[model samples]
Structure formats: structure tokens, C-alpha cells
Target chain A: MSEYTPFEMIAYTGSRVLKDERIVFVGTGLPIIAAMHAQLTHAPNLYMIYEAGSLAPILEMGMPLSVGDTRAARKACYLKGLCGAFELTQRGCADYAFIGGAQVDMYGNICSTIEGHNYDKPGIRFPGSGGAGAMAANCEKTIAIMALEKRRFVKKLDFVTSIGFGDGAPDYREKAGVLGSGPYRVITNQALFGFDEATKRMMLLEVKPGRTPAEIQELVDFELIIPPDVKEMAEPTDEDLRLLRDVIDAEGYFLKRVIKK
Target chain B: MINTVSSNIKNISTLEYKEKKFEYWGPTPDESRKLMVNKSHALKDKRMSLKEAVGKHIRDGINLGIGGFVNTRVPVAIIHEIIRHGARDLTLSFQSNSICPELLAGAMILDPDRVSIKRVELAWWGYEIIGIAPMVRYLATNGIIEMDDYTNYGMSVRFKAASMGIPFIPVRDHGGSDMELVNRGKMIECPFTGKNVYLLPACHPDVGIVHTTAADMYGNARIFGAYCTCPEIAMAANATIMTTEKVIPTESIRSYPNLTEIPFPVVDTVTEVQYGAHPGASYGYYWFDMDHIKMFRSICEDFRKTGNKDALKKYYDEYIFGCENHDDFLEKIGYKTLKKLKDMDGGQPIILT
Candidate 1:
């Protein structure tokens, strides 16, 4: 019906990944918007656990400034301490954890640590891993949401801030004593990627509309594992965009004005 | 070739190296027990001025824990006092900080040559180096303060271990990341399961400061919403300082014993400072003063651009040093604005049915 923003598309895609009645471990930014969208839309029974310990919050009004925002705890089912919230993940309670990172490698290992190899002397230091590492290690599955850029999609992360499929081998996480299976899908601006079962390397699953495989290849620094049955990513429908704009992000705090023509 | 053995070999070697290099920094289990036993004698009316609390307890080179997650319920008033009193060589330990750590690092409070105080050391997990507060990046980039990083969960569990008076706690997370490499903890076999687990050592700060909605004159504190790590921090720290919106009578606190997060025995000082968590939200009391926070950010940005402390000095002078105390600071915020903020929310705590 109307032109939509890329953030709307990304949020819509992220919402689509969630199933009904799943327990999602969500953080502040875009993940909150996506999870809220899912709750309002298809997955009404989805339970949300904010990293700051607000569990199943009834997000009534304005978007919460942070996971620990008082609004998040306002009608929450259970408000735990930081230890208790993460302990749930450790106990294998969360069904999905939505996270974003600075860089993600072919193996889906995300790096939010120092850009330079040296920890002492970093060329550029992003914020060190918060709860993303723990969630990735403990959740049943992790969904990495980030803008698609060549710099972000790398051959090797500067540092493994969160383990996905370590070294792209089977039983790698098991051997590493990681309880979770790492990222199941990486939702990006241009496309969606899923890990190959045999290799555990990220493979191109779908390209977004109006984008070609050649263009997607050009955007990535590393070689993409292209599957033969790769299909075009479904664009946000009229209803999806309507719900996203009207109900989910009514204030357009996250999805509004972010998209550039 | 699966190449599983090589990876396994690499991991085992790393694990062995980590174990060999592991060193505990804080008090031992026995020492912690002794300290708790010594300190857990009696509960007194620890009510004192914010100045007295900061000056008497927060000394140079003491490991400090400032409690809060992001902007909610942070000890801003206490932090301002710390800066004003010129506490030096303070080693700050926190998990998932927002404005508190950024202000501490950016305020040039740690500049030894300039301020003539010992440089501050910061050990944090998940700093607000993102869009919210990027001054930490500037501070770290210039080597203004020594920095150590940990995962949020790791830091929380460390506080839990300290509270429990245990030497270290076993965790299944943070095994494969760079956090494992840099973490002071060692990878050990869980004797029960014979599986590898990270043993995060106890973190007992010399002083822990927390701001809450209400507390009694005897230091029994209660937080209305989102009690992140304040309770754990209070239990873990050697001494706890509480700043509250109001100091209620002991009877009121006793009426709701279940809501008491920090008991009087654990708290060493109780300072009554209304709107104490200014520029930050104090749950049901008031929302975050975004304009003030923006002003803080602008000052930081000016410092970043000019590489001069003039802007920071001006900010400190006007907001912190200029004010005599929390009351003076509240005066600067203006009563009308405060009333408006308080009234906007009906001046009531959200009671969830």
C-alpha cells in the first residue's frame, strides 16, 4: 500500500522467524521492536524476557529506553535480577535470543569486542559483549540482526565475542561445552542466511526483492555458500507493514525515519 | 577430514594455558567469611549526609561497585559527590553501566597530572560505548584510565559468588569467546559432570553505592521496579551506601518486610537525597531527564572535539561542584520541572495486579 523502510523490512523478517508461544530473550534496540511486532502480530503468545530482568512485560506505551527501563517492568510477569534473568538462559529456558553485532563471520561467530586483535591495544574498541555471549551460548537458537554491509560480513571475526558454530564443524558447540546451537538464521538488509547442517557455515538462503545474487556476492567480503534452491525473500506485505507501523512501532521510535531512499 | 581433533587440541591447549595463568584478585572465601562475621554484628542508624558518606568510606584505590543498569536507579548524586570530594585511585567494578561509568571516565576525575589525584582504574562488563554513551571509548582510546572487560553474566555471577561468600562460581557460558581468554577465571572440570566449566571468582567491592525509591533511617532500602543487581551488590560489597528519595520511619519499612531488598545490617550508610537519581530514572519517582542527559552528552562531545577539559569543567562546576549537595542540585533542576515530572506520573508507584 505504502512505501516501507528497510528497518520495517528487517523487523518484519525478524518477527516472521519467531514462532507462537516461544520464549524470547531480547535486548533493548531493534530486537525489542521485532519481538514486540511478533507479539502483536502472528506470535501473540510469545513470552519476552528483557536482559535487564523484566520477564513478559506488557509493553503498553512508549518504547522502553533500555532493557532496564522502568516501563519494561511495569506489568511484567516476573522481574528478576540480572543474575536471575541470565540464569534462565543458562537453564535452557529461552527459545530464541535476538542479538546484533559489529561483525559476523562465515561460521556465524559474532564479534562485538575489539576490532584489532590486541585486547590491550585495540585499533577500535566496540562495547565488550554484554549478555549476547551468554545468550548465544545458552539459548536454544540465536538470531543475529544487522545491516548488510561488506565490512560487517567478514571471513574471520576480529575476536569471537559470541560463539555460533565454532570452526564450522559438527558437534563443535558440544565439544566446546556450549549448551546452545548458536545462530539459526542471520536476518540482514539484503538477504537472509542460514547455517548449513553439514558444514555449519552460513549459506545464502534468500535474497531480498529487487536484489540479485551477483549484487549480494559483491557486498560480502568472504565467499558465500550459495545453495541451488535459494529463493527471493518475500517483501513485507500490506498487512505486515500496516501492523508494524500502526501497532508495533506506533511512535516510529526505531522503524521511523531510519530508512533512507 | 573432519578437523575436529585439531580444534579440540587447540581448545585443550588454550584451556590449560588459561588455568595456569588464573589468578584471584579479591578476598578468599575464609577472609570473606571473617569479614562478614566481623561486620554483621549490629544494625545502627547509619543515616548521614552524602558528603560524610562519600568522604568517610570511599577512599583512594578501593574497589567500588556502583549499582544500576543503564540510567535507571543509578547513584548519580553519590557519583557527583565522589567527584566533588576528589576520591582518587578508585577502581570501579560494574556490569552494564550507562551514565555512571561514562561520567566517571569522562569527567577527567582520573587525570592524575591535571587533578593531582591517582588515576582511576575501571573494570566493567558491557559499557555504554554505543550510541547512548561513547565517552568510555574516548577515555579508553586515550589511555586515560586502565580498563578491564568482562561479560555481563560473568560479572553478575561474580557478584553472586561474593554475596554467597564462595570462592568462585561455575558457569557454562563464556567458554569459547575472547572473554574466556581475558577472564581472570580458569576453566576447570565440573567434578560432578566431568565437563569443562568456567570458575568466576568472587568480586567483593570495598564499597557499593545504590540509589532507591525509599529507605528507612536505619538503612533498610526498597526499590520499586527493576532491581537489577542492587541487592547482590549490597550483599557482596564490604560496605553499602544507600541514597534514597526519602528516609521513611522503621515502622513503614517493617510493614512491608518482603519488599526490603537491602537490610539494615548490610548497609553502612543511608543518605536521604530526593531526586537522587537525577538525569536518570528512579523507577516510579520520575522519568529520566533527557534534556540533562543530552546536555551531559553535548559536554562530552565538546570535550571530544576540542580535546580540552573546559567543557567538562564547566559541566562539573554547574551541575556537581557548584551545588552544595543533592538539595542544591535539585534546586538547580528547578522545583517546577521536578513537580511536573513527579505529577506527570500521578506521584504513585505502578502497582501491578
Candidate 2:
């Protein structure tokens, strides 16, 4: 058994879904790592668009400090403004969008705003949404990465800031003029999931090394579909770990906090 | 209370009889008028020093509104003082799409509760999280602090409405999409666009803390490059705290007054903190400190995973707070980290700023 660092795990999870000819709208962090891993391995031509408007620029390794990290400008073939990024997304130019959801329901509606317990007073607030609204609505396909937990994966979202897969993917599409295919997959540390193509509800596709089907199911507030063909996700390889470490080079990021005697 | 009121009436009566034979029932109407007048802007139009004016109201839980988009136009000096004083629970509200590395560093080393309402994290290209985005997500997942997420246009529209002082602004865009959050009633929504359109309310914050390259003593602030939504946010806030690099006489504003977007009347207090956006050193003032950016990212990432501020504070004390100035912050984080970061293969670090 090979050891998997957090970075390697991130790259492996991302590589599973990203294939060639996929133009992925990427945010910073895990999505970028995953996209990069895909670029390194199977999907050499994976088109990665940063929110600040770089398309398929050569990204430096390790985690980016931010989406606008100078690396983006240094590595890109082209650069566009915030508004320009949306223009591309709205026109169905992007193939896949990797986004994060604060709260998600069984329907694939995301609540990135307040937790929805109190509309007037939120427990916490984020920087206002940027192109997420357009990307969530217009992109051809979407993938949401929410770290695992019942709080994150809920029965019903407090609100849907972004729509991935809804109650009836077809029904929501008719109601909303949404052009995208909805959330294609939901990636978390615990497992990998996708919506049932027919029902558009979450169906568990793969699980992490230490997770069991029942354990994964129990953590979700809503019912998750466990397909009969569910398999264990491939653990991170040593080479993958080395690349991730070299590229992301987050030395002493949490070393002091790691409780060394 | 009745005896005091009666005594006050008698004293007024005696004084009036001795001087001009005036009658008083409830003290003098002029005295009451004076009291009422003193309550509103009666400081006699005097200009005070930055230390004197800024000392009183700077405290924790205070929301600071920064100008500019990311690191381009932030108030560096005030941020420096904020770190110097160890301000806590300082929720920042900005118009630009996301957080900057400097601000992220502050949140990482200063405060981990990077309170904001941006819809997404790291929306800009090349901006690195320095570990803040993942940290923010980690903290949000762990319930360390609240995370208010909105879509990009959603936050912008909300800021626009806030600037206009409109109670709510209805957006026709983003309707009938999965990303239409405001319409779902998860946030404030208008009844008309049940589909994809949303109603964003005015975001009148507690304080509008901004920094500009130059300003007049009368408090007219002008920023060079990418104004973002700073002026509008300042106008919408309850109080506006401004920091400027250069301070000119009020008469200086008369030359190119129209350029002064923030008038003296709009600014509550102005601190002359030069070269303020440290680590993200203000454009044209100093080169961007890549080392500082890496430190900020690393700290943010550490805070995100552990949700431990004590540890963060220790790091800050060792590196950030221990430093005398921005240069020290750069030194403690070390050029090695930045050089190592430079060696990474993929994209450059994309900071939210």
C-alpha cells in the first residue's frame, strides 16, 4: 500500500473525471490540482480557465496562493478580465466547471450564501459571488467539490446559489432557462459521486480508502445511491505525491500545528 | 429628577432677572437648542492628526471596507496598524470579486475569520490562495466561522444596489440557472423573478476603510488604477475610514477637484499610512512582494486545516508581529519559500486579490 499525501489525493480525485478535450473552468486549490494532474496524465489537452481569465496557461506546481497569483499571468497564453471570463462561459464555450458549494441538497442546488437558518442575519458570509452564478447556470457541465459531512451534504439546501443537478434535471431545466448539463459530479474527501443520469439525484460512484459504503451513506443527510458496480478509488501514487509536493511546496503550512513532541 | 428640573428653572430665572429679565420654564430654549446643535457635526471644522482621530474608534468586530481590486488598491498603512494593534473579529467587506494575498495574510496571521460575502473563492487568474481558499473552505466546513457565499454577479449587483441606497435591486440576469441564488429565498429575493433573477439588498456596512494614493487635508481621496467598487462602498457605509499615501492641503483639491471621488465630508477619518498594501505592496509604490504572498498563503492554508488561531498567532508572533515593518514580514517568511514556490510547474499562485 502506498501512502497518499493530501496533495496527491487531490490530484488523483481530479484526474478520475477530467479527460482530454475537456475545457475546465477552474478555481484555485483542489480543482486546479486535479486539473493539473489530469493535464500531466491522461488529459494533456485539458483546457483550464482561471476565474481571472487565463485559458490553459502553463500553471506552476504546488497550490496557487490565489486565483490571481502572478503565476496565472506568467503562465497563460491569454488573459481576460472578470467580465470576459463570463462572456466565454455564457456562450457555452467552456466544457466543464469545477466549483465549490457551501451547502448542497439532494437536488444539486447549492447554497454558497448564508447557511439559510436566518435570512436577515447570516452566521457567516463570503466575498460576494463572482462568475459562479453564470458558470453554474451556463457552462455545459459542472462539478462541485464540497468536503464531506452531513452539514455540507444536506437533505435540502437553505438556498441554491448554484445549480448542479436538481430535483428533476429536466424539470429544473424547463423551469429555469439553464443551459448547462447541471452538476455532473460531486467530489469530496470521503467519496466520489455523480447524479443518476435519469433522476438527477446523487449516486455514489467511488469511495476513499478507509471509507465503507455504509459509513459514507450515514454521513449524508439525504439518501445517496450506492451503485452495485461501486469500486474503491485508486489511492495516490508515489510519483503523484512527489509532483504534488514539488509543485504545491506548502512547506511548514501546518507543520507547527501538527502536534510534534 | 423633579427637584433638579425645578432647581434648574429657578437658577435660570434668577440669572435672567439679574441680567435681562427673561422668563424660563424648562431652562432656556436657546440652551436646549445649543445642546441639540452640538450633537451633529459641531467639531468646529478643525483638522486633526491621524493618530488623534484614528485612536478612538479603532477596535475589534469592526468591519473594514477596503478599496481597489485585490492587491492593486488596498489601504496598506491602516492594515499595518491593524496588525500592530492586533485587531480581532475584523470582518472585511469589499467590492472586488475576491480576497487579496495581503488581506489573506492578515486573516491568516492576524485573524482567521476571513468574513466576506464573495460568491466564489479565487475567481481571478494567477492569484494564489497562499492557502487561504482551502483554509476558508476548511474552516467553513468545520464551523470555525460562518461563510457567506454568493455568485460573482450576485455580490456585484448587491454592491451596486448598496451604493445606490436602493432597498433591493432586481437582477434579470442569472435567471433560470442553477447559480441563481438570490431568487431562491436563501438570500433576499424579489417576487417577480422566481426563475433565475434575484433581489440583492443594500449592504450598508459599519465602516468603509479605504486607502488611496493621494488625498487632500479636506479628505478627498483619489486612487489610480482599478477603482473597483471602493467609492460606492464608502458612500454606502455608516462611517468611512480612509488612509492615503500623500496628503495635500484642501486647496490642492481645487486644481483637479473632479478627480476627488471621496470628499472630505464623506471621510470620517484619514490616516496617512504610506506604502500600505504590504506583501502585495501597492502598485507603483513598491514591487509586489512574492515572499510575503507565499507566507500569507501558507498561513491561510494552515489556519484553514487546523482552525487554530493560537497556532496562527504563534506563527504571526514569530514572523509577522515580530517584524518591525513590511520588510521584516518578508524576511521572516523567507525568500526560500518564495523561490521554492517559483519552482512549481503549473500556474503561478493565483491570489484572490
lDDT of 2 by residue, A1-261 (tens): 566654455457877788798788886567777787778778888877765446667755334444544455445665543434555676777888787757777766666544534433434434334556557777787788876788888876654556555555355553454567777887876688888877888889998877798999988998988888888887877777665555544452321123212
Question: Under CAPRI classification, how is model 1 graded?
Answer: acceptable
lDDT (Cα, tens digit) per residue for candidate 1, span B1-353: 11211114133111111222544444556765677789855667888998999888877667788788877788999988887777556677777777787777665543543222222222233323225355666655555555555667878888888888888887777776666666676666666766666677888888898998788888888877778788888888888888998888888877878888888877889998888888777777887776777778877767766777887877777887798898888898998888776654434363211
TM-score of 1: 0.92
TM-score, A chain, model 2:
0.89
Docking class of 2: incorrect
lDDT of 1 at B131: 56
All-Cα superposition RMSD per candidate:
4.0, 14.9
Per-prediction DockQ scores? 0.49, 0.13
Global lDDT of each model? Answer: 0.75, 0.54
Instruction: Report the backbone clash tally of model 1.
Output: 0
The 10-residue segment of model 2 chain B with minimum total lDDT is B5-14
Give me the displacement of residue B195 in model 2, in angstroms. Answer: 8.1
